[model samples]
Target chain A: MKHTLSVLVENKPGVLTRVASLFARRGFNIDSLAVGTTEDPTISRMTIVVSADETALEQITKQLYKLINVLKVQDLDPEEMIDRELVLYKVSAAPERRHEIIEIANVFRAKIVDVGRASLTIEATGTGDKLAAMEDLLRAYGIKELARTGKIALARGSRDA
Target chain B: MKMTGAQAMVRLLQKEGVEVVFGYPGGVVLPLFDALYEAEGIRVILTRHEQGATHAADAYARVTGKPGVVIVTSGPGAANTVTGIANAYMDSVPIVVITGQVATHVLGTDAFQETDITGITIPITKHNYLVDDPADIPSIMAEAFHIASTGRPGPVLIDLPVDVSRGEIDFTYPERVNLPGYKPTVKGHAKQVHQAAALIAKARKPLLYVGGGVLSSNGAKELKELAELMQLPVVTTLMGKGAFPEDHHLFVGMPGMHGGKFTNYAITETDLLLGVGVRFDDRVTGKLATFASKAKVVHVDVDPAEIGKNRPVDVPIVGDARAVISAITAELRKMNAEPRTDAWMHVIDDWRARYPFHYHTSETAIMPQYVVERVRELTKGRPTVFTTEVGQNQMWACQYLRITEPRTWVSSGGLGTMGFGLPAAIGAQLGRPDHLVIDIAGDGSIQMNSQELATAAINKLPVKVVILNNGYLGMVRQWQELFYEHRYSSSTLPQDCPDFVKLAEAYGCFGIRATTPAELDDALVAAFAYDGPAIVDVRVEREENVFPMVAPGGSIDEMLGGIPGGPVSEMLDEELFEEVWE
Candidate 1:
């Protein structure tokens, strides 16, 4: 099963490598991961999506705590969390179908982040599903390039405590 | 108040009550070694190899219950400690390894003898530090020892750059260690302890499975108290060999692959298995899905990660084994727990009577088991510690040695590193000079760090090195004979193997070789009587195999050799049990 884990760790050098090496060593594939400074400058929060079972995830969580830098670990409920991924897709836009591509992007609340002579780079930011939907709809126009900032997440206000 | 980082390090060790340290020196570590020279309290032994130094320190920690200390130079010296670190990590031995790194300015530049020692050891060590400032030395040293000796203790590393060591600081050993994130649960949860006690009280066939954690936590007293009070039969893992008194009536035997026939059977037959500090490793629980299938397990350990890593448990208590056991003992007393019905003991006794661990002997050939048994006999009623190299020699030693006390039998259990025994003996002997320390090694493995005979002789620590001299790497040879088509290949030792006796003599230690059973006891006696280190090389049968062995994928019930029905599956059929007992 795929689970999203929010890990808070010290912002010391090599902390990221330590965290990443752990996931790799345990055979847990990180489908998506984003690390950034938390409200406290000394601590960094990592948003990671790992594909593992409940038991393996438990083991991984315990192993993470063993790291001197790691402070806390939490498994976020997909339904009770607000998550987003930012993606930029360069779709080949024919002069005739350019309006159609823009219309689909508009429906998805995406914007044209970049424009080339023959392509429009659509920047989409929302939940994983929303970005995937936009990318699927733009595929008809032929995507020339694509890049994504893997998903980042936080629990909803009910869990703000 | 100003002192160099290296000076502060020596001071901190002195404060920690470190009597001796084992290590090898190189360019980057010259400052630390220089500091040692000026220091008064600590003693240092220079090992021939960095790996040997680390292993020696590791053994020192295992036998003494004090965190072992190692100091070595950077690059090769630092990298060489990796194996020892991992070995200590896997076995949960408390060790603090301080490695000299290239100066901080040249760290990332890959200057001469620069290696990412901390990065390399990150996974293997419980925790590690790369010292950038001399002032942090006291805190880092304090934290390093604290982490290494705390809950689920393991090796911790401190990478001290030469520049940092050269820097001066106002050295003050921290009065208190404050790490918000590093709290170990020393006390058990009352409710869980109650639950475990209830489970045991109701169990008709409760078996206490103990592991290395019991010894590390000093839980052996608590474990024995509970076992005796409840009349719970105990089976130890290889790492748990000395945790429970071998002579105690409640003690059954060590279990798992290469375990005794009755021990494996008893484990298979138990209904309730209270695993204390045991991970139920694959070697201990062969064919996991089938292992203890009917048993409801209650696992108590200090490391929560190890609780369900291999096998699931019904009741999981995450705390120090000693504390948890004490809690359970208290709870059991309140509930008035009773011993299980005597029927189970009858079965265990029958199995013991039918298939005891025994070795055949001859007038001409020295049997390895006989040698171990004799060592146990000679070392009886003495403060003796035994360690062994990996493979057949290790198994035989584990099988035959009588460990009456905790911290008496130390081996490379988890990692099973081959060259561990000899250097480990040096460490063990140094730690307990009044006690007898012996390394029962195989001909193949003793050669790995036999140069450590140099370390032992130079120090004049009277450790005994007993070599079970079979002409082959006996364990692998046994495997090839059983599994493969008997192509021994590289399993065979060279025909012209080094004369261990001559080698020992050259190293300025007592040396003797025994080829017959009559000579085995005399060689051991002479070796033990020697005032200095000695090596007793006993030439055992070339084809002799240590067994009660489970084939790689086979269940514990499916033993391959050593016992009567071993290797012949049909013999283990109901007919054989009935016939053998009759």
Candidate 2:
């Protein structure tokens, strides 16, 4: 089981290394981690999707809290969170499939952001499963270009992220 | 006071609280050496070999929990430190290796003795730098120290072009490092802590598979409390030998290859493996797929790369070991403690009685096991520290001695490097002069850097060296004997033994020889009774082999006693006696 956690930490040199090192020493595998500053200027929020079961996630969160610089760690799950992923996908669509591609995009609520005759760019936002399903449906159509905003998340309740 | 870059370097070291540095002098490093002369608080030790200097620095780091600093010249001088840097990298020792390069003008031109040292050392170091500007020296040096000492500590190289070292610049060290990509995660997740607490609350057969990280994090107390609260038996990796008191009932001793049979059994049978500060290295987890086959592993470490490097983890706590363990213990405290059933304990006792750690009795000569046992007896439950070099001697120490405290046994765990014992012993002796410090070394291993005897003598360090002389690379020879039809190639020691007594005397240290058990005991008594450094060379039978031995990649069940299959004479029909004695 993989858990994605958003952590707010002090922007300091060696802090990322310290975080990575903690995972390495503890023998935890971080699947894909995206670190960037949030709305708070002084604090940097890191989105780390770690591949570990529930017990390990708990321990990882507790350890993160112990760091002097880390301010908070939040686990964004489907039940209590609304997750959005922005994907810029370029698909190689033949001139003959242009009408078919537009019809498919309309069904998934995807917008045609770019058009280059042979290539078409689609912008989509949804849950990870939905995005993955869309990709699977479009595989036969061919995807020549693809980019994603690795799952930016927010809690559903009024609690600040 | 404002100073030149060279002076600033020395001033920065002084301010950083570095008391000692080990290095050799050469063309490019002369400026730094000259500045070191005027630098009052910091002292420097000139090593015969650059390799020795780096090893000394590495040993210093291991002992003090601080970054060891080594300074050297350009090109070959910088290249000579490759092995030492690799050694430190392998073992994760905190060391800062500073080397002089050709002047900036001649850097790319391949001047007299210039090399792209930063590039060369990048893969082997935690980080590296090439100082383009002189003013950045103080901050760079401070950052180097910080990087080398924090997180998953390892060697960091700083290749200074001669011009940069000699350039004039103001001196002011940075109070904090601002590395954007170098942030380290230190705390556990609150939800993760709660889940871990829940796991512990429900676990019937819980075991703490502790490793070197426990000692690195100084989290021994937290680990012990968690284990005790959950009533989980603790087994340690080689580097984590003393994280918990070996005398405790919950302690199952060191696990994996060469580990106590009971420890392996405990690991095999556990339902939950709460591994704290361990990487599940190959040596500890013999077969990755079969390791803890029935257990759900909870790995907690500070290094990201080590996670999932071996066994798959059920709970992967990617954070500092100390922080995670402390939180788990705190969370565990709130849960109602459930009493453990004696059924599993009974099975462990049965395994203990069946396959205890016992050696064959040989009346023909002095056994290395006995020697190790004697050392433990001599030290008792005090602050004694034991550092060992590679090969048979290290194995003997691991098997025979009982470490009741953390940070008492420091050796080259990851690298398994020879010549590590002597310098590490010197560093440990210096770090804790009041404690009895000993380095058990093989004849072949000690010779790799025996010149360190002078280091001991010059410093007047009371480090007792117990050299087990078998006249060959014993471990390799044993492998050859077992698997390669006894085709002994370069394993034999050439010619005759050097007069070690004379060698010690030349270095201004006392030396003693022992061939028999009584003689060995007497030599140890004298070495311990003395107030200064001493070397006791114990001559043992050349054919002695460490047993019960497991062939490479072989399971413990296939162990060969002194003789194959049939138990050795002393161990025969002495099950209860074996447990008591071992």
Candidate 3:
């Protein structure tokens, strides 16, 4: 199962190393991870999504908790999480179907980030399924460019993963 | 607090415990090499070729179990390292390859010596980065090391532009690497462990198939315990040769092509195949459809992509091999025993009797098998590491050589990479200086990176190199003779050797030549007795071919045997071998 672990760490020297070394020493499969600062300047948030067994999850969480700089870690379980994915898709919007493409974007609540005479950039934020559906619908219109932030998530309610 | 971009890069590498780098200087990489020169802690060893640099780094990693570091220039230099990167990827060696890319401004402009190296290496590397900002250097380097050394370890590239390496920055190495989608699991699931145990307990003819992942995860002890508890006969892949003690009764030796015939029969007839850390490669499994057809295969791997990539698994456990093996061993403590003593052992013994690792003793010339067996005898299975280059030499080493412990045999299994031995031996020697490390090289393969003798001499690494001089690409020549109607093209080159003894002397190493068995034995003894690197060129017949080989695109059971000039046919049956044995 793919797990998204959010770790809030001190933005300082060798912090990335402390976390990465822990994973390497333990032997875990880290699929795709993104680390950057949140709204706070001093604190850095890392979202690590890797697939492993339940025991591995426990071990990873336990290891993360032991780190001196890591403030928090959450295993964003799929059912209890609201996973949002952002995609910026550039499509070939011929003059005739430009309006039609805009209508499709509106239906998905996606906004047109850029407009060109023969191309359109659609910025969409939703579940992965939603973005995948949007991409499929827009495939007939011809896709020129595609960029996606491979799924990030947060817990649905008072529960934090 | 402010430092030059080059200094920052050096500082970053230093913090990551990078002691040495293998690379060559070029226009694009000059600034980086200059910075390395100025740096105190990091030492750079200049290689004759960029590919050699990468392979040396890879060999270092394979031996040390740490990420090997390689630095090179862009364009041709970067492209040259691609083969090494692919070799690492296929064999899952962790290497940090830092290349000097064209400056950011000149990128995409196709400037002189500029190539889209990052783009070219996308599929080959675990992760790659093009540092646009000097500040990102530390973070990127840290992340690259992390990614390279972490689960399913492979090559990671950092394409640092010349300008980026020269630009000024206030250096503060990253303390944290935050990748959202990249968290690996270090622990095995309790429930899955129990499930695995239950499967093993119930299995009648269970076979344990170990792979390189076991060595990578440091799970040999756990694997041994698990094997002991279950009493399962173990068969390893080419890369998995050293995972278990080959001298043990339960150790059935390697499986698939060139593997022990008993191992092949066990896999073919087994009721359950507990495949741990192996990626069902074509060499291991001749025809996927017929492989382990009678057995229920339970695959355990850290990488999820590999689980269903080859043969579909009856039970797929995605976790670290060591952790999973420990967990399974722990779970097995609760299960009742059905020791496979009488029936299973009898069958395996029968198979062993039927098809033994044999050769017709001849006094015509020195045989490659005799050399390998002699090496094995000299080592006494005390965890002597053997690294082999591709072709007949590699096959001979795998077939005749014996390893008694985990992580003792390193080779380019999946890639079948030639010219892999010398550098790999150097890496293995550096990894464990106390252990005996040997590079079994073919004449054709040795020339690929013969310059690494300098690297060994400079480092004073005692890597023993044994070159099987056949004067031809023996494996390919055999293929041409068999399937291609004897149309030998570019396979045989009669007069291209550069007096290897002189070459070794020039590189500040000892060298010897052996034509007779006693000469070969003396050479080996001398090579092992040396305090530093030594090379032994064993001159074998030019037309020699590796036998008991499964013809290309054929089943493992369909083996070809007999001498190169002799009438070849299917090997004799089990009864004939038993009668001879008796």
TM-score, one value per model: 0.96, 0.76, 0.77
Summing lDDT over every window of 10 consecutive residues in candidate 1 chain A, give the lowest-scoring window. Answer: A132-141
- lDDT value, candidate 1, whole model: 0.88
- Candidate 2 wrong stretches, greater than 4 Å: A1-161, B339-341, B494-496, B555-582
In order, the candidates keep a fraction of the true contacts of: 0.58, 0.00, 0.00
**Over the stretch A1-161, how does candidate 2's per-residue lDDT look in tens digits?**
87778888887554576677668767889876777787878778788878887768866876665444567788877577776778888998889998888887888899999899798899998878888988987888999979987766667776665
The complex in candidate 3 yields a DockQ of 0.05
Off by over 4 Å in 3: A1-161, B38-41, B336-338, B381-383, B562-582
* Maximum-DockQ candidate: 1
TM-score of chain A of 2: 0.84
Q: How close is candidate 1 to the true structure, as a TM-score?
A: 0.96
Off by over 4 Å in 1: A94-98, B565-582
Instruction: Candidate 1: give the clashing pairs.
Output: B560-B567
Q: Following a full C-alpha superposition, what root-mean-square deviation does model 2 have from the true structure?
A: 7.8
Compose the digit string of candidate 1's lDDT tens values, residues A1-161: 98999999888888898989988887889999999998999888899999998888899899999888889999999999999889989999977888999899899998988777899988889998888778888887899999998888999999776
Q: What local lDDT does model 1 show for residue B411?
A: 94
